[model samples]
Target: MNPKISDFGLARTFGGNQIESNTNRVVGTYGYMAPEYAGNGIFSIKSDVYSFGVLVLEIVSGEKNRGFVHEEHSNNLIGHAWELQNEGRSMELVAKCLGESINVSQVLRSIHVGLLCVQRHPEDRPTMPSVIMMLGGEGPLPSPKEPGFYVGNSTQGFYDGSYGISSNSEPSITKLNGT
Candidate 1:
C-alpha cells in the first residue's frame, strides 16, 4: 500500500497572499519535517514541499528515514539516496520489490524531483507548479543541492545507540535488519 496520510497536526491557515508563518508548538514528523520548521518553527509553503520530498523518498526506497541504518555508513535514508545519486547509481535507490516492472525513467524523475524539493534552502525548492511540470516531463530538471538535516559519515560497524533520536510524537519506528 502507498503512503496514505490522513492528518497534519500542525497545519495552520494562511491568509490572502500569505506564504509563511511561525509556530511555537513545533510539531511534525521528525524525518519528514523541514529543517527550518523543525528548528525555528518557521514554516512556509516550502515546508510542505520538503515533507513531500521525504514521502517520495520513502515510497521509492521502501525505507523510513528516521529508522534507516546502513552498515557501511551512518547516513539515514535521505543521505543514502543522495549518495547513490551522486555516484550515478540512482537505480540502486529503488525498492528491490519493484522488480522488472518499474519504469526506469519515471523512477529516476521522481527521485530527482524529490531531492529538489528537499533542498536545504527553501528558496531552492521548486514551487508546487514547477514540481508538477518537471514530474510530467515538461522540462529538464536542474541538479539538486545538499538536503537539510542530513547526517552522513563513513563508518562500518554496528549502530551502537549513539544516534537515532526521534523528535516527533509519532510512534517509535523499529527497523529489523536481516543478514
Candidate 2:
C-alpha cells in the first residue's frame, strides 16, 4: 500500500513559513531516517526525501537498506549502488526477478534519483518537485555524492543489546536530541 505522510506516527506538522524543526527526541525506523534527523534530531523536508529515496532503492532492488551485506565488499546497499554507479554498472542494481520486463533506462534513472535523495547533506538532496522533474526526464541530474551512514559494516550501536534483540531489530522507542 502507498503510505501517507500521516501514517508515520512520528511525523510533526508545521505552520506558516516554517520549514524545519528541532527536537530533543528522535525516533523512527533506523534505515529510513536521514542522518541529520537520526544523528542530530534535525527534521526537515530533505529528511523525508531521504527516506523516499531509500524506499525507491528498496523497491528497485528488492533489498532492505538496513542489514544489507555484500560478500565481495563490506558496503551496504547504498554504498554498493554508489560503487556500481561509479563503475558504470548501475544496471546491476535492478532485481533479477524484474528480468526482461524491466526497462533498463528507467531503472538506471531511478537508481540515480535514489542516490540523489540520499546524498550526505540536506541541501544536496533534491526537493520533491525537483525529484519528480528529474524522474520525468526534465533535466540532467547531477552526479550523486556519498550517502550518509555509508559504513562498511553493521555496528552494534544501532541495537539495544539489553533487550536481547538482534542489531537489525527495531526498538520499541528511540530518543535523540537536536542542537
Candidate 3:
C-alpha cells in the first residue's frame, strides 16, 4: 500500500528518549487526536498510535470516527466498537460491503489490535512494533482497555467549546504560536 501522509504544519521532531513533547498550543484533527494530546498539550509516540487505531477502525467500519452517530447508542466509532467488542459482537462493526468476502478471524483480530492501540491511557497502548506482531498473529493479544475520547450520552463541551462543528469537517489543521 502506497500510504501518503500530508499536513505536517503542526508537526515537530524529537530525538533521543524524549517521547513526550509539551506544547502551549495544540492543533490537529479532533477524531484522530489522542486524548492526552487533545486534553493537554502533550504529544508523544503513543499519541500517534492512538490516531492509527482510529484510522484502523474507520477503515474497518467504513465510517468516520468523529462524526459517527447511532440511534441505539450515542458514541463515536471508537466507543461503538469498544461496546461491541465488550459484548463479543465486534464483527458487527465490519462494513457491510465486506460481507462474507473477508476472513472473519483476521477481521476480528484486526479489531482487537485496533482497540489495543486506542486505549485511554498511552501506557496501555502497544508500541508500533508490538502492534505489527499482534496484527501478524505472532503472539497472544491482550484485552484492550477503554478507548480515549469515548463520549457517551453527554453533550459535554470538549476543549473550550470547539467540539461538534469542527469534528464534522475535513481534517482540521490549526497553527498556534507557542509562547
Candidate 4:
C-alpha cells in the first residue's frame, strides 16, 4: 500500500535556482502539520520531516492522533511516546495488532527514527537523505531531544467558569497528604 510520492498533492518542483514563494493558503493535516507551517505559513523540507514523524508515530501505534487518548495523562500521542521512550520501555507503546512475531529491535529502531524526525528543534532533525541512511542501517542515528509541544510544564490554564471567564494558573497549592 505504498503511496506514490509523485501523486502527493503537496509535491511540487521549484526549478533550478528559483526563489521560493509564500502564501496565506495554509493547507495540511492537523496533527501532522509542522509548527512553523501551522503558525507562520512557512514550509520547508523540515516541515516534511515533521509530518513524517507524525506519520511514523501513527503507524507504529495504530492510532489516529485526531482522537488519541491517554487515560492518565495531559498529553497526546506524541507526548506519551516521548515519555515511553525516556523510560526505556518504548515497546510498551506499540500497537497490539503487531502481535508476538514483531521484531523488538526493528520496532525500537522505527520509534527512534520517528522521534528523531519530530525533535522540537527543526535543525536537530535528520534530512531525508540522512533518514534514509539511518533507516537502511548504513549510518548511526544521532540522539533525539525533547519533541515539540511536550506537556511537562507545571503551569496550566484553567477556566474560572464565572461569567464565562478563563484564567491561567499553576499547579494547585496544597499541603501533603492527609492535610
lDDT of 3 at 112: 94
Candidate 3 stretches with Cα past 4 Å from truth are 1-12, 152-179
- Ten contiguous residues with the weakest lDDT in model 3: 1-10
Q: Lowest lDDT 10-mer window, candidate 2?
A: 158-167
**Candidate whose TM-score is highest:** 3
Model 2 pairs in collision = 26-176
The models' CA-based lDDT, in order, is 0.73, 0.72, 0.74, 0.63
RMSD of 4: 11.4
Better of 1 and 3 by lDDT: 3
Give me candidate 4's TM-score against the actual structure: 0.74
What's the TM-score of every candidate structure? 0.78, 0.78, 0.79, 0.74
Clashes of each: 0, 1, 0, 0
**lDDT tens per residue, model 4, 1-179:** 12223112232433323223333555665566555555445555666777788788889989865456688876667778888998998998899998997988878888899899877667787776667677778456677887765565413222111111121212122212222
Task: Please give the lDDT score at residue 157 for candidate 3.
Answer: 32
Over 4 Å off, model 4: 1-22, 154-179
- The best candidate by lDDT is 3
lDDT score, candidate 2 = 0.72
Error of 1 at 143 (Å): 0.3
